[model samples]
Target: MTQPIVEMKGISKSFVGNKVLNNVDFEVLPGEVHALLGENGAGKSTLMKILTGIHSRDEGEIYVKGEAVEFNNPKESEKAGIAVIHQELNIIPYLTVMENMFLGRELKYGKTGVTNTKKMKQLTKEYLQQLGIDLDPLALAGNLSVGQQQMVEIAKAISVNAEMIVMDEPTAALTDREIERLFEVVDRLREQEVGIVYISHRMEEIYRICDRVSILRDGEYIGTRDTKTVEYEEIIQMLVGRELGTLYPERDAEIGEVKMKVEGLTSDAFHDINFDLREGEILGVAGLMGAGRSEIMQSLFGYRAIESGSISIEGKPVNIKKPTDAIDAGIGFVTEDRKEQGLVLSMSVKENLSLPNLKGVSHQTVLSEKSEKELVDDLVKRLNVKMAGQNQEVRMLSGGNQQKVVIGKWLGINPKILILDEPTRGVDVGAKKEIYHIMNELTKQGVSIVMISSELPEVLGMSDRILVIHEGRIGAELKREDATQEKIMYAATGGE
Candidate 1:
């Protein structure tokens, strides 16, 4: 048997008085992919943080290659051959790809204290070649698409010669082809005898890539088992402590007449778009990356300048030139990029929950703290958001909880039309169910929803109608009864 590459024995940690982690044990072998499975707030992240030195364990013993070790900080962990790629890509937007990759550890000019630009470029090219990824090293990081940015992050991690990598939801924003490329990279790393600790909520991905699976429940160690020995359902039960029946609630949509219509919509990014969203119905937009699904939502939400368009709410023409206008017109947009556009990380959960509808929590045109607190508390309970309290900073919450906060913000406004762009992206299964419940409740109240999703199963399972977009135009419209994965993919690919 191969020697263990890393191990954490009896790890215990906490914040203030709360025991976030209690006697957790984790181990990973060289050249193997070890999957960390858990629900939101199950202490997966806290345990990993201890390994990477983001947080020191209150009590624990760490053994690296059968030798005792402790990381004092992230740099120390990196020096010990551990690296991390966060769910949120961490590339500097304005910097070039090569510059971002060689940020702190640049090539020096032979005993001189000056960096060598030519050597850095050459090394970057070699690294990309080694990974079988073709990218322009001089291109600005932000100018690349999300898929390309993710590849750059992987290359950066590998450039440091890391022997162990912690990947946190690496494929959350990627397409099928991008995911395949990532798997190829992982295979190469495994051949190099590098250990990878993979963290994700997608069970299919875990079984597809990992050799062993370790589960955690409520901050305690459950068990580590061979991937082939356990069924997926059993793993999910261990995570959430219950069996999930139907992912989507009952679809009792009334199918009312169109409440909002867009005709001849043209923007610099897209053109000649037309669609109608009906009251008491969920309409899904299906398309590949860069097929203009998100662009349409942004244009409709008044986040982008529209060259020409006609929008009518309730058969009455209205001008939506800004986000405030869109909100006032009963349109609430939940953007795909939650961290960048949805929530203000520095504020409390209560502040973020009340953001879209401060007026509702105000008295005599002045803010009422008591009413705001009450409203936020109610939303927290309704959404099943896991947090210490409403006063906790939004940044401190997990990815799933932050997503709930975004949905709560829009629901607080009580909009008649809701546009959800990848609403369940990067969320855990439990949070996804809660979001589906929220949608069910809203549709029952006559609110319209337009869901934009890359996950075909989610679209078919949840939407009342599906609109497939290709090259900035609608290719086909399928009723929920007639929708299928192949049909939607055919339409999304322009029937090619």
Candidate 2:
């Protein structure tokens, strides 16, 4: 057998007396794809950070290709042929793609110290082409879509000649087509004998791409198994340390009267949209990426302008020109991008939860801490949000907990109509089940829901009615009893 490219033994980490990882052992062979699976806060990130030199280990030993190494910083780790593509991308938005790719390692001419722009752009183009990414080298990073930005990050890693690459939720923001491209890149990298450490909550991806799987639970190593030899159920049991019976709970909410009506709704990204949401039913909006599903939700929630449309709530015509108007009309929106638009990362959990309904907990321009605390406490407990405290910064929470906080903040308003766009985008399977249960509970209370999801299974599993969007228009609508993956895809692709 070939020697392992990277090895870690007896690794442990802690923060302020809270142990995050304990006596973990991990290794990856050259050309091998190793999956690191765990629930949120299960020490996956802490362990990876120790390997990448972002955090110092409490006690551990690391070896790179039979040589002991100690890295004092990320730069040192990078120089040692280690690169990490973080879950949250690290590209500078305002810079050009080439500029961001060569950030901190610019090509320069001899003595003069002038940047060799031509050489950098040429190398950037070559790397992008090799990865099957079609992007302009001079385009602004912010102007590119999320998936494109992810590709750029991968290209940056390859440019560094990294022998071992760590990918943290690399496909969380990717589309189906983009995911295919990424798999192709992975195959090519494997042929080059590069090692990959893939960290994700997605089981399907792990099974499809990884050769071996390592399980972690509550800061301890459970076990490792060859991917082909292990059953899916066995891996799940090992990770969560229990049997998870069903991925999604059964839908039992009764459909009531129509609570929201849209006729001839048109926006820059979508046209001639029509849908009716009942009081206790989930109306799912399904589409391919850029099919205008999210745009429709944004327009309905008054975050975007509707060029032509008529909206009615409970038989009353309403003009919603802004988010405030939508809130006043008993509507709430949980946006698609939680980090950028849904929550303030720097703010406390209590602050974010009360941001939407400050007026209800304030009087004469004087805020009531008592009322705020009561409201936040009730919603947090109701959503089962795990947090250090109400005063803890929201950014410190895991992806699942952060999503719960976003949902809890919207629930504080007690709106009659709720729109959720990719509500479970970055959460784990357990958290997804919980969110679905919360939706079920909301419907039981007669709160109408409009869910936009790229995952077909999620739409088909939870929705009462499914609407397929194609090229900025509603292509088809199918009742839950009639909907199937084939029919939805056919319609979403503009099939006859």
Candidate 3:
């Protein structure tokens, strides 16, 4: 029998006397991609943290290659040939790719301490090429897109000579093209016999890549099964402890009159965009990576400079020069990069939610604490946000809950038009259903929506109409009944 690359038996953990994991058993073998499946707050992160020495396990036995071991810190795990590529990119935007690859461990001449930039850059170039990436080693990390930054992280892991790499929601920020590139990298790592602990909310990827699947539900060990043998519903039942039925909840809202109109909208990234969002309707925008879907929406919301455009709300023209202007125009935006644009991680939920609706929560120049509390309280309850309390730091909550905070904060203003960009990215399956339900409810109240998503299923399942953007232009307009995955792909790829 092949020795397990990493193993944990009878694993358990607690935080401030609250149990998070209970006797969970997990293991991975060489050249295997083992998926750790769970919903948000299901203890997947907790278990991985304990394995990497970020947290202490109350009970457990860990083994590396059948040798008993204990890692005191992440550095110790790295020394033991283990590395983690976190969901959050660790690249410093100002640093060059080569500099980021060798951060904190710069190569230097022996005894002289002179930095060896040439050798590091060469190594970085070679590593990036090994993964079939065309990124320039000298390029600034800050100038790269989210997907490029992610590929940089993988090159960093490979440079560490990692035998086992943990990937947490690796594709959450990626486009379909970038995801394909990532999968190719994964395949190469598997060829090198690298053990991969794949963590993600996406099921399709598991079917495509993972060899084995383990389930964790509310901190308890559910079971493990061969990925090929296990059915999708069975895995969902294990992770969520319930039959999810249909991932997309059936929509029951009616589409109505035009709520907002955009004509001849042009920006540096996107051009000649025109669309009409009807009240109580969802207008989904689908496109290839870098097709300028986000730029179009940002331009509409006054987050980006528009070269030429005409926007109207309820048939009345409005000049939106900035985010505040758009807000005043009754337009709310839940940006794609929520952590960077939507919410302040350091701030409490109450403070973050209150930032967007100060006008509604205040009286003249004097802030009204009463009104702010009412707004925050109502949103929390309405969103069913799980947290220690309203005052808890937003970063302390799970990814799903953090997303709700982003969406809920916008609701305080009672906007007529809402824009959700990659709304369910990095969120778990259960939370996704909740968000869909919320979207349905919002449309029921006559709040128009414009959803930009890479997930074809989500676009098809929720949108009343689909607009396929090809190279920054609307290539095709598809009705809900007419839109199919193949048709969207055809239009997105510039197939006229």
lDDT: worst 10-residue window of model 1: 232-241
- Which pairs, if any, clash in model 2? none
Tell me the whole-model lDDT of each prediction, alpha carbons only.
0.89, 0.90, 0.92
Q: What's model 2's lDDT at 181?
A: 82
- The residue ranges of model 1 lying beyond 4 angstroms of the native Cα positions read 136-139
- TM-score of each candidate? 0.93, 0.95, 0.95
Candidate 3: tens digits of C-alpha lDDT, residues 194-219: 99999988888999999999999999
Identify the superior model by TM-score, candidate 1 or candidate 3: 3
Candidate 3, poorest ten consecutive residues by summed lDDT: 247-256
Residue-wise C-alpha lDDT for candidate 2, range 158-256, written one tens digit per residue: 899889999999888887788888889998888889999998877778989999999888999999999999998899889778888777678898898
User: What is candidate 3's local distance difference test score?
Assistant: 0.92
What tens digits encode model 1's per-residue C-alpha lDDT throughout 1-496?
7778899999999899899899999998999999998878899999999999899989989988888888889998888888999987889999999999999898898999898999989888888888898888899998987778887887887888888999998888887778888999999889989999999888778989999999998899988888988887778777787898777899986879899999999886678898888999999999888888889888888888889979999999989889999999999999998999999999999899998888889987999999998888888888888898888999999888999899989888889999999999878787888899999889989999999998888999999999998888888899999999999999988894
- Runs with alpha carbons beyond 4 Å of true place in candidate 2: 134-136
